[model samples]
Target chain A: MRRLGDRVGMAWAWGSSLCLLLGLGTLLVVLVTRGAPAVGPGLLFGDTAPGDAVLGRAPVFDGIWPALMGTLALVALACLVAVPIGVASGIYLAEIAPRRRRALLDIGVDMLAGVPSVVMGLFGFGLILLMRRTLAPSATTGLWLSALCIALLVLPYLIRTTQTALDALPESLRLVGPGLGFTRWQNLRHVLLPAAGRGILGGVMLAVGRAAEDTAVIMLTGAVWNAGLPAGLGEKFEALSFRIYVLAAEYRDDMQLAQGFACAFALLLLTCGLLASAHLLQRSLERRWKA
Target chain B: MSPTSGRTRGERTAELLLAGAAAVSAAAVLGILVFLAILAAPAWQGAAHVFTWDWRPFHGHYGILPMVVGSLLLALTALLLALPVAIGIAAFAHGLGPRRLARIVLAAVHAMTGIPTIVYAFVSAMLLVPFVREVFVHGSGYSLLSAALVLSVLILPTIVLVVHAHWHSMGKELERTCAALGIPRGRAVLRVLLPLSRRGLLTAAVLGFARALGDTMIALLLSGNAAQVPGSALDGFRTLTAHIALVVATDTQDAAYASIFAAGLILLLVAAAASLTARRLGAGNGRTEAARAAPR
Candidate 1:
């Protein structure tokens, strides 16, 4: 009877695991099959042309060049803003924070992670609207507001990951550094940070992937569907994620709709590729540390 | 002679700076909460008419009662569908599978954590909606059922990961002892493991609920954009998140916009409360574990 029960439990477990795999697999296959046939150099590089209106027309197959460019710019600016502050906070939490303060910081990060994306978008809109009304009436308000919102959204994740990496280091390393007469700052810069470099990079990459996929905040701030390409920070620009939302929601053109799918497919591929590379880098670093 | 004194000074300075930075982050989180409260203050001050079931954003009627009901119903339905499946998967990964297979399953579950919610919304809009509509024959493709189904998939990864962590954290001795007692494996697991992990399971459920509640894209894309109370699963409805997205997208600047802010505030409160409850449950469970360990 005991053995039979174990068998039943085992069967249930494997069955459920298979179900999860099937769910994700189905999603990936659906996206790929629908979007892959549309991918080509023309679809990748061309701008959305107005002439392709008929059913057989190539379906506004403009490459996602502008959306992709905007995403890159937004993500780059967000990373620039988030990484240093997140790392510095992580350093504080891991090495310098008192116990009570560390506890508070952990809770704060968790709460930040749990806040809904829409709220963030609302916050960005309200803050940016005020800033725009007071300061520059230029288009840069949306861009900078979106960037800052994304930076805040990603900050907690990076800080959490970096703190975990730093915590994983052996006490002997810290002792050795101080024994060698290195100051605390020098020890952190030269020894501790380098040791945790791969983990920190992994965290940053994860944050970047998150920033890349987000639409709600970008929709509220930077996104202006069908806008011409942006010339400056103030200019309204479309993003890949936001465009996917727009094409699927507001547009009636099926070809333009397919373009949205293609953009989504591209974004997914880019994110997955980056994640895979980061995993490889982490593994290599682990091997080096062991050696 | 003064080496220890100098090191202490530097450490103190670092600690002070770290405390200040952490306080800032905490303040940011609190500021969001405060902002939501202030935004919602107007609706609270308004007459009882605002609480009416009808949500006519075109008029001054900013009643969010229907939106709240829709959001709760959608999230609750998703949670009910997902909880059993997630627990079964977590149990299997931690206890039932072969060691190597378990690792692979766990990795896949973790990978699901990284997939963006918007992708889930997209897939549901493209595939699940059609599948449901075809099967139902009478209902529209975008219904509460479709939204719930999409959200179920979105929340599954989170549920599995949290419960799996709980299962793995149990001591091997507990399992071995139960097996040695000649108890049936399933009964032993029910009596021992499940009770021990009850708090963790509850935490997972609450967290999943919070996630489902907060999701905007799936609800927006699949709930049919109708501001109706769903009498049946096949009926169309609009959620708070979806309402905010739709309202903001149109750039409305009437009482409707203020109502959107009210909805956003409600969402923030729900999320915060859910998280706080989960954290407290987790802390209580930790104390129990420590108490259990103390006797031995």
Candidate 2:
């Protein structure tokens, strides 16, 4: 009876794992076969024309050049906002924070990370409302608002990764700076940072992939349709993730639905590329640093 | 000069700036909570009806009980769907599979974490929706079951990653011990490893539930947004996340807009509670906390 029970448990494990892998395989195959053909210069760089409109007056199909650029811009802006603050805070926490405060600070960061993206979006929307009342009388949801929210959204990832990376460094390197009469700032800038650069970059790549694909925050913070390329930080923008949602949810025909799949494929390709490179970068850096 | 006793202006300035950054990072959490509270103040005017079942904002009814039910139901169902697979994958990676298979399985799980929620929703919208609609012979393909199915795939990585991380911290000592004692592999895993890692499993489930509850796209696109308590898996229902998304898109005035704020507040509280519970459960297990904190 005991042997039989053991056999059942082991069989269950193998069976479920096989099912999961098979499901994933099927998903990848469907996405690739259906979406691969839509990957072309025409799809990447062209505009959504009036002819592409199905049921609505506005076009339903998108070529995604504008969205591609918007995603890149949003990610760049978010990185600009997140990296410095996150890295600085990380440096403070890892190197200088009091032991007691460190625990409190860590919990704060964790709770912030746990906040749902939609709540973040609501916060961004509230910020826009606050801005309209005070800072910018003409304030509206747009690139800057989305970028700011996404920055906050990804900040915890950067901080945690930065702290972990710095903490992982050998004590010898940490001591070399002080032993050589270097100040704290000099030690961090010259010795600690360079060593942890690859790891921090890996974190940034992960954060970028996250920011690019985040739809809920952007949906409330100014993702719009046929907005064209954003001319300034205050203008609304398009994104592939949002585009994919709109197309899939609102598509009128099979062709439009196919375009949605294409958008998904494009996003998958971009994020997967980043993930692969980040993984490789971390691996190579580990080998070089350890050797 | 010792590192701790530094008196240089540059060092002092750097420390102050870095500390300020940390302060700002920490304060942002409180700031979001306060802002949402302020935004949701209007809905509190209808506080009595807030807990009631009627939710038609246009008709002046402001209850959110249905959305609450929908969100909970969808998350619970998704957790039920994903839990077995999560445990199985963890066990297989632990030792039930070949070394090459383990490596491949781990890599696939890692990659799955990177896939966007939108991709899952899109695939489900295209494939699962039609299947559910046809097979169930119920409401249009968009139902709680459809959303739950898609969401199971979405939250799979969270549970698997946490459990796997906990097992790693457990190490191979137990396996070796059981083997040396002449215990069979499967029975050892079932009796020893499974029982030992039960806390880790609970932590994983709580975290996965939080993730499932917070997801908007699957519920938005696949759940059909019927704004009612679902009687069955085939019934369409609205989750808080989806309700907020829908309201924000279509309405920005009147009670409906304010109701979304109320919804946002509920989401915030639930998320905070879930995280707190998971953290409490995972407190002593630093590896579990690290895995839970990792960006999904």
Candidate 3:
């Protein structure tokens, strides 16, 4: 009877695992079959918007170029803002902060990280409102505003990863700086940072993935359905994630729906590629460090 | 001879700048709270009407009870669907599968966590919603069950990774003990490991719940946005996140706009409560490695 019960339990576990793999397989298969046909060079770099039909004729081609560009620019801008502050904060927490202050900072980071993206959008909305009232009267939802909000959204990931990476380093590395009469800043710049560079890079990759895929924060900030192209930091821009949401929710034709699926596939590729690269980089770095 | 005398001015400035950077995290948290609070404060004037269940913005009613209930219900259903599969996958990686296959499964899960929520939302709206409607013949493919189905997939990575971490930290000891005592692997996992990781499982569930509740796109695209409590899994409903998005998109009127801030405040408070509960549970679990991984 005991043996039978154990067998049943083991079967259940195996069955569930198989269920998950099958589900994931179906998801990917659906995306590939539904999305692959729409993913041509025109979809990659063509300029015809989905709505740009001339005199009742369907548009010759449609592309997500502007949205792709907007996503890249948004993620790049967010990284510019977040990476420096996040790394510095991580270093401060790991190496310089007092015990009590470290605890306070950790709580703050965790709390901020836990805030929902929609709330971040709300926060960004309020910031724009405040700016309109006082600082910049022309302040509105746009690329820069979206980038700022995304920076805040991904900040905790960077801080956490960098702090953990620095914390994981050998204690003897710290001793070298003091033994060599190096100042704390000099020690970090010359020894500690170089040692932790790959780990910090890993965190940056994670932050980039996060900033690229966020839609809610950008949805309220500036991302739109049919922005031609971004001309300035303060202008509305298109993003793939936002496009996916709009197209899926409001598509008028099967063509547009297929476009949405193609966008989904492109985004999946971009994020998964980054993730896989990050994993490989981390592994190779670990192997090299061991050697 | 003092160390202070030997420090350069550059070093002092760098230290000051780094400390200022650290303070920015604290400042951002305070800023979000203060901004949301100041914006939401005006809704207090109409607090009585706003807290009720009716959410007819155009009719001058702005109650959010339905959205709140909808959000919680969606998350609860998603968690119920995901928790077992997540634990099973973790158990597979623990010892049920061959070593090579387990590593591949773990890596796949790690990659899945990085897939954007929008992809999941789009896929569900395109495929799963239709399937659910066809099979169940329910109200327009968009319903609580459809959203929750996709939501479970979205949060699966979070729960699976957490459970895997918990098992990684604890399963080794159980394995060694079982080996030494000649205990069967199935008995150790079934009777020993599952029961031991109760706190960890609770933490995973809470984290997954928070993630599902906070998601806007899935709720917006698939929940049908009916602004009523769902009578069944097939019923359409609104969630606080989706409500906030819809209000921002359509209603820029003063009362309607302020109502969203109130909704945002509620979502924030709920998320805070969830994370706090998870942290407490994790601390009780007494495994810092697993706890650190929980926030993902």
- Give chain A TM for each model in order: 0.86, 0.89, 0.90
Summarize candidate 2's per-residue lDDT along A2-95 as a digit string, tens digits.
Answer: 7787778788888877887898899888887777666665575444453443223343335676787789889999999999999898888888
Summed over model 3, clashes come to 0
Better of 1 and 3 by DockQ: 3
* lDDT string, candidate 1, A1-291, tens digits: 856766776676677788887877876777777776667655655654434422224423355666776788889989998887777787788877778877777677667777788888887776655555677554244567788888877777677667767876777889999899888877887999999888788778877987888888888776776544444666777688887787667657666666666777777777766666556656666676656
What's the i-RMS of each model? 6.6, 1.8, 2.1
lDDT of 3 by residue, A1-291 (tens): 988977877777788777877877887888888887777756755555344422213323357777787899899999999999999998998889999998788777777777889899888888888898898988888999899999998888788768866766778888889798887678888988888888778778878888888889998888888775566798999899998998987888876787888899889888888767666655655665556
Off by over 4 Å in 2: A47-61, A133-137, A284-291, B1-4, B184-186, B284-296
Model 1 regions more than 4 Å off: A1-9, A47-61, A132-141, A251-254, A276-291, B1-4, B7-20, B47-49, B175-191, B284-296
User: Tens digit of lDDT per residue, candidate 2, span B1-296?
Assistant: 45457767777888899999999998898888888888788777765366679977766777788999999999999999999988988888877777788788878887888788999999889888998889888789789889998999889888888888887778789888999999876667678888898888998898899889999988999988988999987889999999888878885454566677788889888887877787788874654234323433
What TM-score, computed on C-alpha atoms, does each candidate reach? 0.88, 0.93, 0.93
Model 3 / residue B223 / CA error / Å? 0.5
Q: Candidate 3: deviation at residue B237, Å?
A: 0.3
Docking class of 1: acceptable
Runs in model 3 lying further than 4 Å from the true structure: A45-61, A134-137, A285-291, B1-6, B284-296
How much is B181 displaced in model 2, in angstroms?
Answer: 2.2
Docking model 3 quality class: medium
The lowest-lDDT stretch of 10 consecutive residues in candidate 2 chain B is B287-296
